[model samples]
Target chain A: MDNFDKIAVIGGGSWATAIVKMLCENNSTIGWYMRSIYAVEHIKRNKHNPNYLSSAELHPEQLDLSNDINEIVGKYDVLIFAVPSAFLNSELEKLNESLENKVIFSAIKGIVPETGLIVGEHFHQLYNISYENIGVIAGPCHAEEVAMERLSYLTIACQDEKKAKALSKKIKGRYIKTKVSDDIFGTEYSAMLKNIYAIAAGIAHGLGYGDNFQSVLMSNAIREMKRYIKKVHRMKRNINNSAYLGDLLVTGYSVFSRNRMFGNMIGKGYTVKSAMLEMNMVAEGYYATKSAYKINQENGAKTPIIDAVYEVLYEKKEAKDVFEKLTNMLD
Target chain B: MDNFDKIAVIGGGSWATAIVKMLCENNSTIGWYMRSIYAVEHIKRNKHNPNYLSSAELHPEQLDLSNDINEIVGKYDVLIFAVPSAFLNSELEKLNESLENKVIFSAIKGIVPETGLIVGEHFHQLYNISYENIGVIAGPCHAEEVAMERLSYLTIACQDEKKAKALSKKIKGRYIKTKVSDDIFGTEYSAMLKNIYAIAAGIAHGLGYGDNFQSVLMSNAIREMKRYIKKVHRMKRNINNSAYLGDLLVTGYSVFSRNRMFGNMIGKGYTVKSAMLEMNMVAEGYYATKSAYKINQENGAKTPIIDAVYEVLYEKKEAKDVFEKLTNMLD
Candidate 1:
């Protein structure tokens, strides 16, 4: 028997919907815990998420939609936490009793603000879970692309090799590709840093900078990622690998990137607050920049790009002035 | 005293113009060798390159535009060969009598067609020039962007550590950034392979593929590059480094990329011959694909991407069918 016959996905975002849709291909029953009762009812009745994944049709039989977190949490052997970084702690707290002995996977891609901990790290500490039971889905995959069934690749990272390989096999399919790596910290750090760079890329685009400038920013961003990943993980990671630089390049340049789009709006002369209000959707980079800036300062890691982004987004510095400073800073 | 004061750029193309302009900033007198007397007169009289770099103004007083290969070869202590890869041998033969004791630096980035020899390797064999006296400039730097004063980086590869460091200092300026590496073959190969992939990226865009598919192609191209680089050089290269994958990503996705533009035309149902006829300039990738394809076959290197490109370009394979085959080939 496979280790996981029943998988529970917690969240109602586009990414959560894509994961559920992908998992259903495994021919296993899926439990989806949505915080909004209306969203759950809508998904149950329509067999589709109208707000996020409107194009992807979910089979009604394969989905177990609920607002009661306990019912879904207790029923599954594998638990996938797909909530945003800010809400992960509250959601984990609600499911703490039911998480015992289940394999927990985190699809959240940011560091928690107050504690400055990655989602998996937080789960490990609060739930007394071994590293073996924790896996992180760090991606070159995007929710928008997943809906189109375009080919995408992801890294499933865990400290325990056996657990990592097992999770890799579980998610590998026609449209979705999975690779296993032992450097959970490296994978997680890359995922977070990419969001920060995407914001910087967006700001450049908003500033009316052409493709020339955008390409330069992305190249430098990846270099910064390499330096930070080395500092934090102290592991041998191929910075050139798809999981690291490849993911950063795609997200930084893509039109559908929310963080880049947010930065672009701010660069086009909107205040950070105004941009956020306009976007309606949360730009993860806004939060990620804060967390990364603090972490870099505390850890003595050098990240000029992230610092410049923080200055623009939080310190109310002019985007053009910050960009000029960034260009001049390069030797 | 510096070993070289006056440098001759033996090709009046965009790359040569950009290199000459950069060298001029270092207080070095540049002799720009052009085969066309009309081009020489146009550059000298109007302070502009009529054919290649029309947008950027060149100061006539700073440049000695000439058709006399002997005069250029005799006056300069260092020669920067910026000729097209196909014409390198013929150009060198023309200047052989005047080439003595002068260091040679190749800016061309391709292998010889029939011999499968890198440009630097050909120089070593034909001129009996020691590897210590030969250097290569390869990286993410584009001629058009360099002329526009955009920030760009290059790897200066030479077997002699002292010569490499000295040359790096000579060219390091505001727009041109330099790094030193010993892997000449790897650097040259990276430069060549990136063009091939840029064509592939262009084809993807031409076929109306979104960023999702393009990212997947670029990511896989980098992986193929890493594998091939290791196989050829037997040295470890960081694909995430600015020299390898960085250059590839910039060229593959940028709008200013000529190779990608050419590939896009072909992918949009234009015949390869028709695309070439329509283009105002030569796309180096079209030539590189032929050279690399031949080399890969001879060396038994697995490069499905290059093969697919060759098939599409020369064998009259349909773009849609080729792409379907490529995706099917991937796991």
Candidate 2:
């Protein structure tokens, strides 16, 4: 618990800012690392994140901000990684400091693109961090909701109960509730897989399905997620828990979800490239679908939803045709 | 299967009309009984129900319509009851025709107020209908969605597989998909219980909780539902199925759900009486919560969601204070 007191959040996204906001409530000073020097100076001059979660006021006095990743990593005992999965490799390459001794927790919700490993496994396998030192932070939460001080729930999963408990205490606040789990693999895999399902939800919505079908799709999605997760890491975890199903619901049903928005465009007949170009961002699900589909090929889980989305995005099958087939597959 | 071929829909509500619409797709002649002679005449002339789902065009040429309950019951081999649970006893009071030979399927999703049992159980215990002859028609399919010809799924649950399959065939259409289940008790109980959870959802939204909390509440609700159903009817069933979780989602999330709307009003500070008076209809959950609460006292399932809604609606507990306590109860 003492080692976890000097926690540093890595990345400058909305989710990272939100985590910092939560940590600021419980800590006298928190380590924050971002690549952009201007953003670091902007936060020092102005007590708010300029790029993301702009309305969330930061306590600069309580923040030990740095543009250099190694400096922050060297100073903090616990490093919470929150960068996008696609950029995780490059971010880690910049870190000369050892994560071998630190209690590492991933606030990242994706599989590292190069390795097809979740951030926790990526850290454990590549960086030699023990499973005991690795943990995951998950949510049925949105960063925007945190900015508004709306009530939200987070699940912290670690093999070490004490480490998970310590992190939970730091993150929980008046509007934030926390629970601990030992299922790191299931929670992280679910966190990554939900983006893909959100895309499926978007496609269904874009293809003109109503609330009735959306409900059914979600019901099936959770079951499919359970099946998929079981293949990767067989555990006795309840898939209906808030960390899995609750997170899926918030992402799939949320209008603010970029993954769902990307899917909506696909369902509305936008090519994958066009949808990404128009949005000026790559949806995390686009990459996740490819990775999960490939991973399922080895595990051999019967995943019709993932298969359909893969066909539409990777195989260039028409969204109409793919979802038309998906309709017969769900119930 | 042959005995269930001659079907009569017994109600004048939107749900009854929706069932008739599905039946008309496969049957050349279907019997319909309504208490309102005016509604029967209106449908006969206008090809749509006058009071509900007016947009659905009925096929009068294939319809055998009457106001007399006995006339329809005497002629048809299968009777599907879709009336409000509160009015069911009065409607059944008029049925002098024996139900001993008939196959009964309930589309009504509430407990019988007088008997405090699910409609399927009420028929089995009181009307002397064999469990094999009783069935339940459940939805993640809303009546409104059926009217729009939006693709939806229905679960037909009967102890007798052939009867369930036959009913599924009669109702399945281009936009309608059907599956059969043998767990009649579980399905009926879930059908009744979802409304109570929907009411709970409305109260949360009414009290200004955001989507993050709603998702967590639903995740907890399904888990609570699985636990509650197991106590009453111990069987091998996945509570995440379309008939259970999917139906719960449609009701809890749909803007069209009267129970949710009723809960929203209560959340917004309307007393139950005022909310009922304003809507000009009773929210079925108001009564269902009472029945379920009393029943749970015997079973003693640890159902926090149902308990909270029951307190708010029946015990006159303040929605704000009750929900504040309820939030801590959910994950």
Candidate 3:
């Protein structure tokens, strides 16, 4: 096994903290870079990420923590980006060092708002990273569950099977399991698409639809996801696989999903602006829905769920009326 | 359309009551028969099923209720059997009337214990009913949801598309939507198989697995169901359809599911016998697991979920130990 030694995690979100926690189990000196100097200092002093995943005890001795983006990017053999898709551009703008040789894996689950490209495609198109050197960390695994040491599954996808397998070994632990897939585009797109579906689920739930309807909505959502992904990246893959349907189920059904929370408020008659304000953060799916709707204009897939979500979020339609129209479209 | 008039519901359970309620929206003088004479009299007097779905009002003026099975079977053109699989044989034993001419549709979600066949197959093999005459009503629906008048979806499947469509029209109402399918065997098998998976889900929850694990288990289950159904009956069908995956989700995730409740108790360290004793009722999945395990032995589909449930429920294996082994089998 060709072990790529210095692996660094970028971003300071809950997912980043969680990924670093997983890497800590296998790697001795894991590199962690965040934009926040205070978070870096806090972790070094308090032994945990105070802003996110606070309950997860971190080993400061095992970490090579820094806020300098260029230093970590230059030193690391593999860089795993966990930043929100909306802010990924600004974080990369601070980087003066080349990413040509550094293997990149994204834990982000949305299209980059600036370019309307998935993180892997963004790196490939702009940063000139080869597809083999780029990878994706897709999750049915939630960061909160990881913090609780609960059993969770992650999919490591890279065109190169060897690199995917190597990364899988680094993340697998007593409570975490990893599967490797060559369908990087499919996995990444499914991960981004599921959040939009989760918002649809939350809106239906908030509109007084019961569990029976929710189950039907989810069944339809997975099929819609399969159709949409196949249009973007044609692949021979099972849509029922844990990476695709499993990821959708966890986000759509989980009470802890922020996208669902945002959608719930929208369904309860709050405008998109009000819902975002109430959440105090923008959901990844909000950007994903807009980008996906635009992409589907060229790559046509019958995406009723996505259309309903987009109409409610960006078009500023009433969630109740949009969802009412949606019920007829689903099986 | 070939309309089959004089539709009758044969059972006194909650499902039978819900079906009768759906029928009442389109049909007048719906035939209803049960072995319980007191319950039949109570419904006639109270205008509702006193024992089940008590909240759903029944119009006595439109119903032809009887305790005599022959009277209802002899008069009705279409019979929807909603009896428990265990009691189905006994229910048929009470009828001296021939069912060869009647179009039979089953709402039962288990295999016949005596025949080790799904309800549709059981009726076909033993009762000499033609495949075209036999049908299935599969659901992502709950009887409780119907009682509450919540929107729910149903799949009406028959080899005869006309029969399926006609029956779908009879059942479709303000709160219920129906889809027609021609895969009677697959839908009926999926209905029975979903119970076993629900038990697997319950055992996992009982043994301390979280939502992440449950999502993966369900995703794996739908794939396993697709593989298993294909082996038994070779057909072209989307396993992600509401009839398959939607039904599984409703049964697996519902709080009202007795199978889950039973499995939860077993996971909490209650013995199978003790769990049954405490509930004072046997879960349909308990019988389903045994039958499905036997069927799979011949079919040769890899079913770790069903096997694990069987070991815990029938083979007297510990829940923790079996689930520990199961975790490794799932992705």
DockQ score of the complex predicted as candidate 2: 0.87
Q: DockQ for model 1? A: 0.35
Model 3, B1-331: lDDT tens digits are 2557779999999999999999998887799998899999999899889889999998888899999999999999899999999999989988799997899999999988988889999899999999999999999999989988899999999999999999999999999999999999999999999999998888888888899999999999999999899998999999989999999999988867999999999999999999999999999999999999999999899999999999998899999999999999998
lDDT, candidate 1, B1-331, per-residue tens: 1476667789988898888878878854688898899999998899888998787778888887789888888888778888888777677667645455777888987766545677888878876787878888876777887778766777788878676777788787976778888777888888889999999988877877666567767877877888777777787666666677677877898887889999999879988888988996678888888878776775766777888899998788998899778865542
- Candidate 1 per-residue C-alpha lDDT over A103-190 given as tens digits, one digit per residue, 9 for 90 to 100: 8888888887667788777778867777888888877777877888877777788887787777677677877777788888888888
Q: Model 3 clash pairs?
A: none
Candidate 3: segments with Cα more than 4 A from true spot = A1-3, B1-3
DockQ of each: 0.35, 0.87, 0.87
Query: CA lDDT, every prediction?
Result: 0.80, 0.93, 0.93
TM-score of each: 0.89, 0.99, 0.98
| TM-score of model 2 (first chain only) | 0.99
Residue A40 lDDT in model 1?
80
For residue A122, model 1's alpha carbon misses the true position, in angstroms, by 1.2
**Candidate 2 lDDT for residue A123:** 89
Could you give the CAPRI-style class of model 2?
high
Candidate 1 stretches greater than 4 Å from native: A93-97, A160-170, A204-217, A265-271, A314-331, B165-170, B204-210, B235-237, B265-282, B296-304, B310-331
lDDT measured at residue B196 in model 3 versus the true structure, 0 to 100: 92
A209-247 per-residue lDDT for model 3 (tens digits): 999999999999999999999999997998999999999
- Residue B12 in candidate 2 has what lDDT? 94
Give stretches of model 2 more than 4 Å off.
none
